[model samples]
Target: MSSSYAGQQIAFLTQHGKEQVIAPILEPALGCVIKHVTGFDTDQLGTFTRDIRRPGSQLDAARRKARIGMELSGLSLGMASEGSFDLDPFAGMFPWNIELLVLIDDRLGIEVVGMAQGPGHSSHVQASDWPAVESFAAGVGFPDHHLVLRPQDQDDTRVHKGVSDWTGLKASFEQCLAQSGNRQVFVETDLRAFANPSRMQHIEQAAQDLLKRLQSCCPECASPGYWVSERQPGLPCSVCGRPTSGYLTEVWKCGRCLHTSVQTRTDCAFAEPKHCASCNP
Candidate 1:
């Protein structure tokens, strides 16, 4: 638990109870105290329901949030988390969640990011009747995971979010259905960390990743957050010994000094013949 940040106070930007997931993991590992900063509306940056489009990339949003927290709390170090959900790139069918945790050290002029991506529960349905809404709710793990209801017409800005109980959901659905000209309500799983258990798990995993990167100091400059900066692809095909589109080198770099070292992939030595252009094409 001994770390350079031991006994330091780090401001965390969150109003959705993310500190419950992030603080416990980071406090014990980094020996730093997490001070939750509130009154700053994080949804101004973006929202899960697409009410306000995020201005920049996921990393940029996280950095901005951290800076806001630091400025509000008058602290040098700050932390923030951002999450995105989409179709799994490889799986193609399942939902994927990418959670990113950022640590901004203004005193050191360095930013560290911890990331985790895996299967997630993020889906939507449109229903006009109670039975249809109930079936959709059960499919998405209702009660345990919350839902958001709105008119099926995208032009309708009125939204009922964080519907966890059956009674609340039913009421929201009826209201949305009544409001909609098409008599249909759009329902989606609530992606907020406090309402969704799956999203919270991913956030916790990202916190663990952040702890590991924080502990790994650069060999050249002794700076915290030395991590893989680049990936060099060209693993040799096992049969023809020709290069393939697989990672062969991982470039680890120091954030402060910019010193870098190349390390070979220990998990893989050769690429499959099917992945080789010469072998396949």
Candidate 2:
């Protein structure tokens, strides 16, 4: 392992206290300081509250933030994080969170990304009375997870964010109820990293993933972040002895010199019968 980023300052732009989780993991391990850049309201780029629409994809937003941080601090190395919420990709039965940390190294002329996904806390409800509001808040892990409230529906522009305590929640609920034209107040869990513990956990995991990627060195060019670029599916079915959907090899590649190599999976040589189209489907 090479210390390519040792003794370097990586600029990070965040207003939601992401540094609390990111700095502790990467600073000591990478021997770099996470320069927390301020004076910019990241909410202008996009917000989970739906007030300001996020431009471009999740990766694009992260790259843009990293560039902004580098420019503000006059550093060649920069990093930024972004998170998105959706239903679980496997079954679409539960809320899911996907967090991305983008590292842009102008000195090395390369970009690397670390990603992680898991269960998320994002829920909403329309309530007309205090009892209903209490039920919804209890269900979403209020006071710790935090919340956002608005009048009428999810699209209502009158939103009150970061309601933590029970007293404050009741007050906000009344305020929204009074402001609502339909007499229904909308309440949801606040999706901010600092406010939501679930989202913060995923962000921390993303930082760890980034550290692993940075530690990996390319065999040919000796560049950092030589990681799996693609997966090949061809593992023979255990019962039928035929190719199945199970992956057989991982294609590794370098980000700088573009050197590539393939490694066969040694953990398992055959796919289960359930995964094979010929044997089960």
lDDT tens digits by residue: candidate 2, 1-281: 55888899999999999999999999999889999999778898999999999989999999999999999999999999999999999999899999999999998888989999999998888889999889888988888899899999999888899899999999999999999999999899999999999999999999999999999999887788889999999999999899998899999999899999999999999999999999788
Encode model 1's per-residue lDDT on 15-111: one tens digit a residue.
8898998898988888899999997999999998889889889999999999999999999999999999989999699989999999998767788
Ten-residue stretch with the least lDDT total in model 2: 1-10
Off by over 4 Å in 1: none
Q: Give per-model TM-scores.
A: 0.94, 0.98
Backbone clashes counted, model 2: 0
Q: lDDT values of the candidates? A: 0.90, 0.93
Best model per TM-score = 2
Q: How many residue pairs clash in each candidate?
A: 0, 0
